[model samples]
Target: MRPVDFEYTSPTSIEEVVRSLADGGGEATIMGGGQSLMPVLRMRMADPDLLVDLRRVPELKQVREEGDHLVIGAMTTHHTVAHDPLVAAHAGVLGQAAASVGDPQIRYRGTIGGSLAHADPAGDIAPAVLALDGAIEISGPAGARTVPAAEFFHGPFTTALDEGEVVTAVRVPKHTGWGMHYEKFAQVAQSWCIVAVAAAVQVEDGAVARARLGMANMGQTPLRAEAAEAALRGAPLQQGALHDAAARAGEGTSPAVDAAGTAEYRRHLAGVLAGRAVTAAAGVGG
Candidate 1:
């Protein structure tokens, strides 16, 4: 399949990108690494009049530490994030999840901003970002503003980004000493996860002080397992305690029945994977 003819422009500045989007009258699509959009375009899922490319924007490719957060530029590649020392030290969950995205080629070509903006429920990175309580910075004709990661996704393949708006960076709180793990179940290597859980635990004096749980492919959007998280808090850092908390993993989720598995199967996987992820993070078991 071939995409329809469209005008393309590679802009070095955000202002120019916004101007191009504005000129296209809401019919423009922004291209970061193009790992996701290229497939969508070739399949004719979207037909935009203009394509605003951000690959030339130097400012969007930087990863820096600001205050208490590690700020990752929107155009930063997954490969860079996976191997970056700053990211590994500050946000290990993100680095672990980024390292598991697709394959080496996809990781080299895919961008964090692109993955979050695409808002796929099965994407590995978004779940880890959600568990880390990340935020996204958006720039548009109106100005710049921030959106929390929890509120960024609207539905599968949809987000809160409006016309003329571009994601400039993602800000994640540094979990310097916390234990983190991303557990995924896929049919084959390099395949999308059928069910995955991202867990970050802060253990204190042999007790779980704080726990964050994010589920992938559990609903229309990546969701936080609030019930499970609440149950884990103050619990002992043991396998039995973690298993009990993970039992409620699918309490509020709405998984879909698909070729990967049935809804019931996914719900079961959620609890099983949550136990594994949380236990691994807490160092309760291998």
Candidate 2:
């Protein structure tokens, strides 16, 4: 299948890209790595009149630290994230999650912004971002705004970004002393996750101070396991506490039934995997 005929423009600057999209008036699609968009284009599932390529926008490809957060350019590749020493030191959870995104080739080309903007519920980064409490920085005709991870995702393949906005960067807070883990179940090495969980635990005096749980494919979006987080707060960072929290993993999830697994199966796996992730984060089973 071939994509419908479209006009292609490679912009050299973020401002140019924004102008292109603004003029396109919702009929344009930005292509970064196109790991996700290309397939949709080929299948005719999407047929935008304009394809704005961000490849020439080099400013969107940087990774640096700003005060207390690691500011990652949206166009940074998954492979880059996986291998970056700074990412490993401060946000190992993202590094671990990025390494599991796809095979080597895909990782080499897939961009973080592309992955997040694609908004696939089964995408690896969505859950990781949720767990990390990252924020997305967007620029549009009206100027710039920041959208928190919790509010950025609206539903499967959807987001809070305005029509002409470009996602310029993602800000991940440095979690130097926080414990984190990412656990995913997939059919094969390069396949999408069946039920994935990313957990971050902040411990103090042998007790849980803060816990964040992000679950993939449990609903319309990469969902926060709020119940699980609530259950773990102030609890001893032990096996029993982790297990109890895991049991509440899917408390508010309304997962869809599909070939990957039935809702019941996913709900079950959610608890099991959440327990594993939380335990790992807390060093309970290490």
Candidate 3:
């Protein structure tokens, strides 16, 4: 299978990319790293008249601290994100999730912005960003705007990105001293997640003082396990409590039944993995 003939332009600046997208009317799509877009092109699932490549945009490759948040450029590779010391020291849970994506080659080429914009329910990065309460930075002809991670995903493969808008970076507030964990069950290391759990926990007075939970493949979008997070507050970091809380991880999720497994099976896996993730993040069982 081959893609339809399309004009391509690699813009070295965000402004140039924006101008190109505007000129293409709604027929052009931005390409970041191309890990996701290339496959779709090969399968002919997408046919854009123009492909605006953002790889040459220098601003989209910077990773740095902004105030109390870590601002990672949209074009930053998973490899760089997984190893960035700033990420490790501040939002370690995000780094843990980035490290778990696909394998070596894909990680080297895949990007956080691309993954978020791809809006795949099973993507590893979105759930971690949700758990970390991060925000998405978007740029358009209207200038820039920030959307909280909680409001980013609208549905499966759908995000809140407006037409002509591009995700410029991901901003995560510093959660230093918080223990973090990411757990997912896949058929193999490189396969999509059947279900995944990302947890960030803060302990005080020998109990879970605060908790944030994010679930993937358990709903139409990457979701925050609000019920489970509520249940964990002031809860002892014990197996029974953690298990009880984790069981609610799928309380309001709507996972689809597919060849991978039934929706019920995915719900079950969410709880099981959430337990492991939260327990580990809480520093309880080994």
Per-residue alpha-carbon lDDT of model 1 for 214-271, expressed as tens digits?
8999999999999999999999977998888987888878999988999889988999
Task: Pick out the ten consecutive residues of candidate 3 with the lowest summed lDDT.
Answer: 245-254
Backbone clashes counted, model 3: 0
lDDT per residue (tens digit) for residues 142-191 in model 2: 99899998899998888998889989998999988889999999988899
Lowest summed lDDT window (length 10), candidate 1: 244-253
Residue 255 displacement (Å), model 3: 1.2
Better of 1 and 2 by TM-score: 1
Superposition TM-score, candidate 1 onto the true structure: 0.98
Best by lDDT: 1
lDDT of 3 by residue, 1-286 (tens): 9999999999999899889999889999899979999999999999999999999999999999989889999999999999999999988888899999999999999999999999999999998999989999999889999999999999888998988889999999899999999998999878899999999999999889999999888888999988899988999878888888877888877898999999888888888898999999988885
* Model 3 ranges with Cα > 4 A deviation: none
lDDT of each: 0.92, 0.90, 0.92
